[model samples]
Target: MNEPLAERVRPKTLEDYISQHHLVGSKGSLTHQIKKGIIPSLILWGPPGTGKTTLANIIAEESKRPFYVLSAINSGVKDIREVIDKAKQSGGLFTSKNPILFIDEIHRFSKSQQDSLLGAVEKGWVTLIGATTENPSFEVIPALLSRCQVYILNAFDKSDLEALLKRAISKDKWLQSKKIVLKETEALLRLSGGDGRKLLNIFELVINSEASDAVIITDQLVLDKVQKNTVLYDKTGEQHYDIVSAFIKSIRGSDPNAAVYWLARMIEGGEDVKFIARRMLIAASEDIGLANPTALVIANSTFQSVSTIGYPEARIILSQCAIYLATSPKSNASYMAIGKAQQKVKETGDLSVPLPLRNALTKLMKDLGYGKDYQYAHDFTNNFVASEYLPEELSGTSFYVPGNNQRENALKTFLKNRWKEKYDF
Candidate 1:
């Protein structure tokens, strides 16, 4: 009863686990491996409360291996070494029964800490099962990442959350003593933001606050009971995502005032400085694009500056870049171009490259007429030549259209003069 309801109701076996069917289902990616006890080192990457930690526990339990746990938030190289030494002594190094070391929030580990894991994972001394709420490609070191397979754990859907509530109601003695009826779940589901653990926490809070023995769960009751002040700012929860989204949208909408307000909210909430900078880096190219190519340069510089000078000083750099990006001419032309091009590739499959465009580096390639009749732009007038670069099937196709802005209008003019009516520019 002292423990949190989530821990008490935590899935004990793979059968009891909920959601992530792609990983734990009969034909899931990890199904056969767990069954055979030939588990590989892997990083479970997903959103918070999606059972990444739970999956790691289940894998170790089902495989019947010695399970060791550490948190990246507090553990360091010394802690890692101690755990590895223990695993080797108890489970035997380079054996089939090597221990499983689960590190929660593995993304929080610094490069040196992650480096410490390399030896243990590579030597088969331990099978590292890391749980991260962030992208492993960005947070994990390359050496460690290469040694482990990354499995994605998706967010819990409506049914998954509902099932969790139902299971908790039936399994927990405390909840069973009261006649609790789930009359409505929208508030719980919405408030949890697709997080199964959060859903249970909110459910337990509502149930415990009730004065009567009988409790009927309704949207209004749930919403009213849950603290409305929670929206102030949460760096790891729904508010974290919401605030960042608002910040990005404000920049794209060309409102510096609103953008700075959201940026300040994130800064006050102690958001990772690099995370904020990275999002701006993306927005620079995605929102500003060719309309103002300089925005990307400024955003990139901001990322590097903040990364070096963190927090108190970084806030100044972030504000400067955010305002510059907001005031810049906005355009999603570059973003749309890649999306349209990718769609075309998917639709066309692998179309053959025209012989003229093919590289004729080898003698055999030249014999096959590679690079034949390929127009050299410098050989023609104005250092430009008209030619069909796309596959013959997609002749004259245009994926990029210049945005309606001062810079891009000049591009439109240049392209118009060169292609004439070919691209209908």
Candidate 2:
């Protein structure tokens, strides 16, 4: 029988699951816990096709616990109650072996629906395993989240996707029977966009269409087939990542033309406009920091305006911000500086605060020379004093490096004049 490709290739165990090594790897905390037969209610947070549902099944199977599956989209409070009742009938409250209730797209469940599961989860009638593409902090209620451990599942890397493809070709009964030769995989990976299911579906489509015994797949053939199928922009799928990547890269490259093109692609694809706006706000600070100080302010205001006035009109606001950021003078000096400083902090363990800079709220602190030798900048010339603020271990450590932009250049000049010996321009 020809079952759906995703169903046919679904992983049955943690060992068979591709990617998510951080969760299932030898040293993984979750793996260790599951191996010890200590299962905790967990919320698997990740993008689609990262094996959230598959992992949930593996956890249930490996734990040797009864598994009950529910979809938030179709299941209601009544359905939840039935499952809870069944779980309670099968296992007592104090028993260690409770049924694992797997809820797919848990974020789609209304508050009342989620509330229904609370009692079962708390009473140990069911060990809830919820999967969400959205951030659980925003979607899942605090009470529910507190009871469940949240584990982040990252997108599959190139190697992980390759491994999945190889497995499908060699292991799948139907694919093994066919004579399939992989000439190139660029289009396959590009079309799948890190989705294992989509990759296999595309592979099925190409292989099924081939008439020759020794079928060869090429980039051009894959593109032609996919394009013929309309290649619709799935807001939750490939187009989402692709468009966002293009949009951010355009801003980073300072190409207004490319930025607008990508922005239009996202808009046409019906992307969440606010998501695009939020990315712009981040780019302003991370990419255009110090170079154009006003960029962040503008991006933030644009986000607010777009949120208030959504869609058809919101596109205009997004375009304005996108173009402005693309054309603005760019510098990542502030971003790089913070990164370097953080690395240094990690390398050299936390140093004690300098005595002069320490708070002198109590008598003991005052006696210990806290704030005693500190030179008040307000009492000095130009409201600036050449005083050591860093600990003795890091007396003159420099962190902020001004960029080549006009504003930073002016800042550099003023700092050089204020502290001739310490501030090097």
Candidate 3:
């Protein structure tokens, strides 16, 4: 009765695992590899309760490999070394179905801790499987991430959640004895926020609250029980993402009141202060841009301040920066410029740099026309020259169209004045 229903009903085999059919179905990539008795070092990236840990365990079980578990929240470099030593002792050959090293919340591990596993993972001492809720590109070291296959797990859809519920009711001996009838599931699903573990825990709580053996579950019953038992927000799960998104959007939308409200919600939920500050810094650039250049400076300062000060005092600094950003004139010109430029680069595929723009450090390069006939802006009037700076193939291509804000309008005027007919501004 004390064990969480999520753990008690945890799927031990692939057949019992719900959702992620793309990875575990008959023709799935993972399934194909498993059949051949080879599993690559992998990173399972997805939201909480999306079966990342369970999937990792299943891989180890199905492959008949020794499995090791570590939580980045608690494990350090020494712990990682100890695990790697144990893994090395158990034979370090890939053919013997190398041991699976599964690190839950691998993103939380510091760089040094992550670095400790590099040798083991590279040498086939262990097949590393890392689980992260955050994007691996941002959280994982490039060297480590490059060696692992990244598999994305989606949140359980409505049908999947319903299947999990039905499975629990039919399979669990205690739940079956309770004779629970699910009259409605809207409240249950909504409250769970697509977290299967949270959903099951809520269900179990509802079940325990009922005095009658023939228990009937309804929307109201679930809402009442959960509201009474659960915290307002689970900062580590879906609510964390949802709240942060709302906070960012509020600032982007220029709604100070809404931004502050979400900020307070995050503060109350005990969210990492630096996380909030980092998002604000991004918002300053992506959402505020050149319209308020000072916003970025302030946001960066806020990040530094919060990181140093921390907690109760940091909340004030965070609030001040949030309000300033929300009230500032917003623009995305710089952000859009880079995105458009990248798109053009992708389409063009490494077009040769214009010879005039190329640096000719060697005499051969100079003789071959690199840096030949190059116009030095300082040699001309107004420290400007109207020469083709872009690659020859993209000479007339324009990626940065100035935004409509006053600051960008001034910039447009400046470019038009200097380049004359070259700039279409």
Question: lDDT score, residue 404, model 1?
Answer: 93
Q: Among all windows of ten consecutive residues in candidate 3, which has the lowest summed lDDT?
A: 88-97
lDDT of each: 0.92, 0.87, 0.90
Off by over 4 Å in 1: 92-95, 228-231
Best-fitting candidate, scored by lDDT: 1
For model 3, which pairs clash? Answer: none
Query: How would you encode candidate 2's per-residue C-alpha lDDT over 273-365 as one tens digit per residue?
Result: 777888999999999999998999999999889978989999999999999999999989889889988988898889888888888999998
lDDT of 3 by residue, 1-425 (tens): 77788998899998999999899887676887865659989999988899999998888888899999999988889889888888888876754588999999998887888888888888899999999988898789998999999999999999999999999998888898887788999999988889999889889889988888988888988888888777766886668889999999999999999999999999999998878998999999999898889999999999999989999999999999999999998899889989989999899899998888889999999899999889999999999988998888887777777778888899899998987777577
CA RMSD for every model?
1.9, 3.6, 2.5
Per-residue lDDT tens digits for candidate 1, residues 1-425, read 88889989999899999999899899999999998889999999988999988888888889899999999989999999999999999864756789999999999999999999998899999999999988899899999999999999988888999999999999998988999989999989988988888888899999889999899999999989997635667777778889999999999999999999999999999999999999999999999999999999999999999989998999999999999999999889999999999999999999999999999999999999999999999999999999878899988888998899999999999999999999956
Q: What ranges in model 2 sit over 4 Å off?
A: 66-92, 105-126, 132-150, 157-159, 169-186, 210-221, 230-239, 307-309
Query: Can you tell me which runs of candidate 3 are displaced by over 4 Å?
Result: 94-96, 346-350, 361-368
Ten residues in a row with the worst lDDT in model 2? 229-238
Ranking by TM-score: 1, 3, 2
2 or 3, greater by TM-score: 3
Candidate 1: C-alpha lDDT? 0.92
